[model samples]
Target: MQKCIFRFIRPQDWFAAINLKDAYVHVSILPHHRPFLWFAFEGRSYQYKVLPFRLSLLPRVFTKVTEAALVPTREQGIGEPPSAALGGGRPSPGFALSRPSLKVLCRPDTKLCFLKSTVNASVLLFLDEGYVKMYLKGRPITMYMPRDLVDTYCLEAKADLPPKKLKLDWVYGYRGRDCRSNLYLLPTGETVYFIASVVVLYNVDEQLQRHYTGHTDDIKCLTVHPDKITIATGQVAGTSSDGKQLAPHVRVWDSVSLNTLHILGTGFFDRALVCLSFSKSVRTNSNVCFCEKKKNRFLFSCVFMPFLSLPSQCSNESVFAADFHPTDANIIVTCGKSHLYFWSLEKGSLVKKQGLFEKQEKPKFVLCVTFSENGDAITGDSSGNILVWGKGSNRISLAIQGAHEASVFALCMLRNGTLVSGGKDRKLISWDENYQKIQAVPELYGPIRTVAEGRGETVLIGTTKNYVLQGSLDGEFIPITQGHTDELWGLTVHPLKHQFLTCGHDKHVCLWDSASHRPIWTKTLEDAAQSAGFHPSGATVAIGTQTGRWLVLDTESKDLVTVHTDGNEQLSVMRFSPDGNFLAIGSHDNYIYIYAVAENGKKYSRVGKCSGHSSFITHLDWSVDSQYLVSNSGDYEILYWIPSVCKQVVSVETTRDIEWATFTCILGFHIFGLWPDGSDGTDINAVCSSNAKKLLITGDDFGKVHLFSFPCSQSRAPCHIYGGHSSHVTNVNFLNDDSQLISTGGKDMSVMQWRVV
Candidate 1:
């Protein structure tokens, strides 16, 4: 089965983007293919009720469904019902067919009209060769971003390129809709966007994992060191200090640690240039600012950062670009405001300085710089010229003039000895050894601010705005970006489909299709969601928040069905039982509250509360039979509770209700309130048990996962100790087969999936 790229459908195609929502999932999975998609983990076996990932001919199957879906809308003015789950399960919400059935496939610039709106089929779809050879600036081209990105950054594309239609001649039977969709109608044929290609490359994958996210502020500049083991990032400046604004900070981070190894910037430079003072009378120091009847003083401390230039009253340009030495990662060159400063990375002190222009020449703001493979420095100046400087030299050895018509904003040295320079003129020119332009491309969206070498002949070009594209020497470009901007707090894989939901402190809950590794949709909440769990039947999702509020959301509509507010504290753990009758909420208030799921989980009522733990609850899980509740507390104690009677199960079988609410101390509490102490003081942050109800696993603060046999006491030793996580494990989950475990790192941003025997 062959598949057509959905994004390639021209604007004039049969329906708008709104119709194609979850187009493929609408195709019913054939009875025979369901068995091949079965997955088992931690002793739980699951079969895909809908189409799963990695299925052979998946695109073709989805395309067939799309073709069938569009036919009814085009011929009869209505869409056919989804055939995938007609008899039982819920069809994808994205595949909602309408009468005079208009289907919006993806999120375009605006909401597409459904039944109320109809597009004329008399208008034909335009064809683009899909790419342009090269282009110049002053001309704007619009690129059709991904189906759901809602991006329409009009970039100037295709300088000196002609308009050509994609002509296909088929003498035999033709099934594809490239030319036949609008046979009699002549398309408007406006150039939507221009693309380029090199090395006979195909289309962009769009789902590659390449984003490096951590910084909260914008990245003013960055440099990959010569060793390729370290990267230095200069951030956009933060808040002002002492009534005076400071430059952005520079952070050096090792590839191994992924953390800032050192910080350097404006703290050292403005020592004596400016002393901002308020009207005050002080006795301790004149530099201090304070006011009082007798004497008042406010003190300020000044610490110097190494190698930063002493800012004079006249010059205060921020350093936006830097480059590491060709042979040594320790040596770096920084250029800003016409001055080139060389510095030692180890000592953080200036080694030398060279002026970009002559003594009488006006100062030119140097915006970008790079190092050639041969140890020569190449800098792009504001004058649209490329200046080449030799080692230990103050004068320019070679200058490439008339390289660009405007300010040269970026420079990159490709591995093939070709020098690439981009400027505000929208021209990306590649120069040979003699500095003559071999090829020029002006099909960029904005002014190129910086360029870094990527895989092979490709280079990562960043615009002045928040966009970066992977461009090849031959001019093909692919955008590599992010899906999430913060650390993930919880992850839940759907039991029925190839989808999962991830929540983060960023207050965003993102749903992703595991097969494509692409985000489906992201919904932002008012408060941070600490935990997310899908119902046993995968129809609804339960979310617990830091504000002690729990929500039951319809999985399809993502609409809140009900909400229950508990004791005002963080509800870190929310779990739905296998039978979907009870919801367990673990809170920081040292209490595990139970809610009886009713009306098919539309609303929940508090049934009972199991309190008595000395410390806050860290993690909780329901027993396989849904009779017992097991929870781990911060004080390294695991407790068992009988939810039916709202009581703790101890050896003594206490019949009386123990009101420990008034007893604040642990020693004064009743013996039945506490279970056997677990973990020997090793803080357990995450815990889970096997489906067989035999083995219990706990991930502790010591970076170890311990497995213990059930029905044991404090004197029992763990049956096994597995170590893998480098930091404290924040979450632990058992797979369906009960043979493997999934653990998430606290700070590493990695989810480890491995087997533990």
Candidate 2:
């Protein structure tokens, strides 16, 4: 059941890989859809500023509203989607057009027939008749029937002459009859697949048998081993980082058990990995071999970024496509910004790497690549050209200019040796082996993102909008559809392993190994928890509650290590000092409480309360040396406190230590979260493991999260509003590598995990 969910997705439906930007916040509910979403909270009957997450039909509602908004834009010249190219199976005309892949089937001999016997001969002489014909095995066997059969046949069979039948894409199935003992493996998109555990019964709805998940990003590339028992998947990183680019991850899993065998992270700061393929020969360990005795994993990474530039401001060449050599298990070719790198999987080394652009020519990025059966390297570039290179050769063997009006996004070789390419210009072009452009299919659903060869000389086209098109040289086609079920709120990625934790008002904290995307365990809490953070050691989790109580729980046991009440009101903030020596609790009591952590965090004792805040403590962070504290309050005032003094830092009689340090938090989820400037935001809730990079993160009512590089003065601070939240951002924390930022949202009842790169 855990693994079967992945089968819902058709493997090449790339458009389904969506990272919704403030999803619920962007969906405006109509008056008709508003009634069910209405609710009263916090003594107010406030309707949602955006669509709430609790609605059962959010997906349908969202899709309907979205289509409504895009209708007018349709006239702007995008053509009708080809009805024939849709997958599933072509729906019968005028049947309200359901997806073709889900029809039901019934026994053939159950046809409707009607006939009556006139035994009375001369007594009225009125008779009606209908004939029935049935097929046995592929031959037709006719049977005469009475016209009265309408009353004798099942209503379901009479109303519909034929039973519904569902056809699936990517089934690439073998012809067989003893299917009861057979197994089926299917991809669910991204980092997951389904393993059919029970014998499959045709046309019958079967519960998901098993599922496996591990990839953290979209599974843009997939390869099945020759044995068909092991599957490899490549993940697509969302984007290169603001200040630096990072490489994406790849993994190999056993199709039988759905267990991950290896996670491949070959290089760092490279472009997002978009394509993958497997070699024909089974790999064996050799002396210079990069793989282990069991399997081979190779990584290809790109380089450093523009120094001092924000990750958003910085950019680099990235790998948009790659594929393995047709026969060699060791050779792989990758293309990016005007360059190609030939890598040896056995040694994890680049055998040949170089830029492909001519010195006097304008540079162009290669968007997709493929290998011919003859072992030639072929690529499609942004400049609208198809470039071919000989096997093991770096020189361009042939170049066909202006292959498409816009950049090409997909390329694949069919069994007949014809090369097909899809481009952003909405054109699909076919080229002969000698490089002559012969035909074109224009005005497709959208620009293709990827393509795969299908049985019977057909092709699967994954589009930019997440739809798939069944492409054939003779041109006959069907449409396939795929989205998240709930709002996400709290997200924390594991430090040492490829695991992460997520929790929300769903009342369950789900732990997952991102490499598998399968939940290891889920714990339902007794009450709604407010904010959460992890200790520096990654061994414990500290969560605060609305009732002014907080608990430090062991990550391994989920058992309370310590639960304490700080004030009469909510304890919105809980943070552990960088050294793990102190735990800070900021509350509604107009003071920040400090506790000394001892016995390796098993115990805590009250140190002293940092007082003098005229109002509730809004936010706090420790000094780099851990000797003093900086805090902000509800009155738009910031104070410097020497914890050793248990009071405000007073430097001299003329002027107290009224020095400015840095702004706390980003804008709040509430509009009022911003200060007088409307630009600089404020929040009563903020956190700081306060690392040496002088960086701290804050979230607020503005539904925004900001990262601050400190040593900042009040006049100006170097910061970035990093990511989005649907509602009030309750807390923000960094993972071990600080490559990803996690946050929890309040009211929205969701948690979203954002990777820095």
Task: Give the residue spans of candidate 2 off by over 4 A.
Answer: 1-210, 215-223, 234-249, 266-277, 283-316, 343-349, 353-363, 433-444, 482-757
Q: Return the number of clashes found in candidate 1.
A: 29
> Distance (Å) between predicted and true CA of 15, model 2?
64
- In candidate 1, stretches whose alpha carbon ends up further than 4 angstroms from where it belongs are 1-340, 343-351, 354-369, 372-412, 415-484, 493-500, 511-522, 553-564, 606-614, 636-682, 692-697, 702-726, 755-757
Highest TM-score among the candidates is held by which one? Answer: 1
What does candidate 1's lDDT look like per residue over 1-757, in tens digits?
A: 0122343445555533223222122233334423233322233333333332234323323221111223213332222222212122233334422322112222122121222111110000111211111001111111112222123211121112111111111000111111100000001211010000000011234322212233323232333333443444434333221123444445555544455555654453222111111112222211111011111111121111244332222124544344446565445566666566554433433344555456334337776667776778887777788888786555688887767888887786776878888777766788875655533433433556455565556666554422345667566665442223334457665656756676656576766554454456667788787788778887888887888887877778788788888888988778776678888788899988888886667768788888988888766655556666656566645566777556776632231222111111111111111112221233445555454545555655544555655322111233455543434656665555554545554533234444444
TM-score of each: 0.43, 0.34
- Residue-level lDDT for 332 in candidate 2: 66
Model 1 scores a TM of: 0.43
The sequence of per-residue lDDT tens digits that candidate 2 reaches over residues 1-757 is 2133234434332111112121211222334533333322222222332222233323433321111122112121111111211011222333321222211111111121111111110000111222222111112222222234323422112111111111111110111111100112233322222111111111211322233445433343455665555665554343321213334555667776767776665353243333444555554321111111112223432111111111121114555555567777567676666666676543444555563555324346777777787899888888888888888776778887888888877787876888888777767777884555433433334455555565566665555533345557567443221101123334555546656666554345656544333456556565445545566677777666556777776777777788787776755455566567787776777877788887656688878887777776666655545555666556534565665445676442211222222223321111111111212223324443332334556665555565554422111233455333334666556555655545655543333444553
